[model samples]
Target chain A: QKEVEQDPGPLSVPEGAIVSLNCTYSNSAFQYFMWYRQYSRKGPELLMYTYSSGNKEDGRFTAQVDKSSKYISLFIRDSQPSDSATYLCGKNTGNQFYFGTGTSLTVIP
Target chain B: NAGVTQTPKFRILKIGQSMTLQCTQDMNHNYMYWYRQDPGMGLKLIYYSVGAGITDKGEVPNGYNVSRSTTEDFPLRLELAAPSQTSVYFCASILAGGGIQYFGAGTRLSVL
Candidate 1:
């Protein structure tokens, strides 16, 4: 199994809707989970970072990790058109880093 | 500060041609990495360096070479480019302890 797995979704949602992105992993050693947002033709930028289990909130974005299920999620509240981008999930286990195929999101007007 | 910068924002190289993708960081970070993004694929590590004069291969390093002679620069060299090597390359740096990586815009390379 791949160390990390994410649905490469072209998820379409209306503005002000809540957007949820998720990832699952088979590697239990992964302790650091990160979410990245990438616009068309640009490199990804870190959106949310979570260490170990639990949740972290930054502005309108929230990241949650459940080590028990090896699942991680990013929640975007009141999404906007500006939030349209590909979301990538990454897991770090010391020296090795693994990333999931990003999910493409489009917030309709 | 530029945080992290990648040069040759875009390039098209013929197969078997050689080229280098340059990456530099002004954050004085010790951990630098090279990653390539393909259509519908997540970023794949090509190479990484912990510090100057130290380098290691990541998951996809077969067609790439890298050297870290200074903390600010970590360039990936493609000796014999292949069509399979065409992708958007990104450079990233982190503060080792925090593990929050900052990425450059990217170098879009096309090997024809």
Candidate 2:
């Protein structure tokens, strides 16, 4: 089984909607979680980073990690068209980093 | 800073052809990685290096090789490439002990 699993979603939402992307992991040893955004033909960039299990807020993006369930989520409030991109969940499992298949999101104007 | 930079934005090779994916970073990061992303699939690590002259294989390291001869460059080599080897390649670097990585613009490769 893959270390990290995410909904490969081309989730389309209207502008001003709240978007929620999620990923689940099987490795309990994973202590660091991250969210990366990749535009078309571009490399993935770190968007939100969180360590352990907690909530972190940054502008329109919020990242939550629940170590108990091995689940993590990224919430975007007041979404915009510029926010359309693929969102990948990353886990730092000490030995190496694992990434999800990435959820594709499209915010329509 | 240039962060991570990958050469040859796109390439097409015939089966059995060999090529090198060049990666360079100006951040002087200690950790460098090579990953390939397939459609609808997550990026898979092919190889990685912790420092100069030190390299390790990740989850998928078949028909591929890497060398870290210098602190600024980590290049991945594909020998006798196959059609299945076609994918978008990404190069990323991270600071010592830091999980946050900076990635290059990526190289789209195809094996016909």
Candidate 3:
């Protein structure tokens, strides 16, 4: 099984909608989970990261991790057109990093 | 400061041609990595270096070579390019004990 798995979603949502992106991992050893946002033709940038579990919030974005289920999620409170990009979820074992297939999202105006 | 920089923002290569994707970081990071992103596939690791003079293969390392002569630079060399090698390449790095990865602007390569 792949280390990380995510839905390759072209999820379309209206502006101000709540957006939820999720990922699951097979490696129980994975601890640090991260979410990245990538615009077209640009590189992925770190959006949020969580060390073990629980939730971390920054502005309109919140990252949640459940080590027990090996699941990670990113929730956007109020989606915006600027949030239209590919979201990638990943986990790092300090040395090696594994990323998911990414979910493409478009916030309609 | 330029956190991480990749050269040749875009390139086109003929089959069997060779090229190198350059990656440099100014953050003095000890860990550097090379990854390839495909259409529906996420970023796949090609190569990574824990520190200067130490390199290791990641998930996808075929048809590629890498060398880390210094902590500031890590370049990936494609000895013989193929159509399967056409993809967007990204270089990333993080501090020795940090979990966050800083990525370059990326290099888009097309093999014809």
The top-ranked prediction according to DockQ is: 3
Q: Which stretches of candidate 2 lie over 4 Å from their true place?
A: none
Q: What is each predicted model's overall lDDT from 0 to 1? A: 0.91, 0.93, 0.94
Model 1: how far is B25 from its true place, Å?
0.6
Candidate 2 lDDT over B1-112, as tens digits, reads: 6789999999999999999999999998999999999999889999989999999999999999999999999999998999999999999999875568899999999999
- Pairs with backbone N, CA or C atoms under 3 Å apart (clashes), candidate 3: none
Q: Which ten contiguous residues of candidate 2 chain A have the minimum total lDDT?
A: A25-34
Residue pair clashes in candidate 2: none
> Which is the winner by lDDT between candidate 1 and candidate 3?
3
TM-score of 2: 0.98
Between 1 and 2, whose DockQ is larger?
A: 2
Q: How much lDDT does candidate 2 score? A: 0.93
Clashing pairs in 1: none
**Per-residue lDDT of candidate 3, residues A1-109 (tens digit):** 9999998888999999999999999978636889999999999999998886899999999999988888899999989999999999998886889999999999999
> Where does candidate 2 chain B have its weakest 10-residue lDDT segment?
B93-102
Candidate 3, residues B1-112, lDDT tens digits: the string is 9999999999999999999999999999999999999999999999999999999999999999999999999999998999999999999999874558999999999999
Supply the global lDDT for candidate 3. Answer: 0.94
Cα lDDT for residue A62, model 3?
97
> Model 2: per-residue lDDT, tens digit, A7-102?
999899999999999999996863688999999889999999888678999999999998888889999999999999999998887758899999
Total residue pair clashes for candidate 2: 0
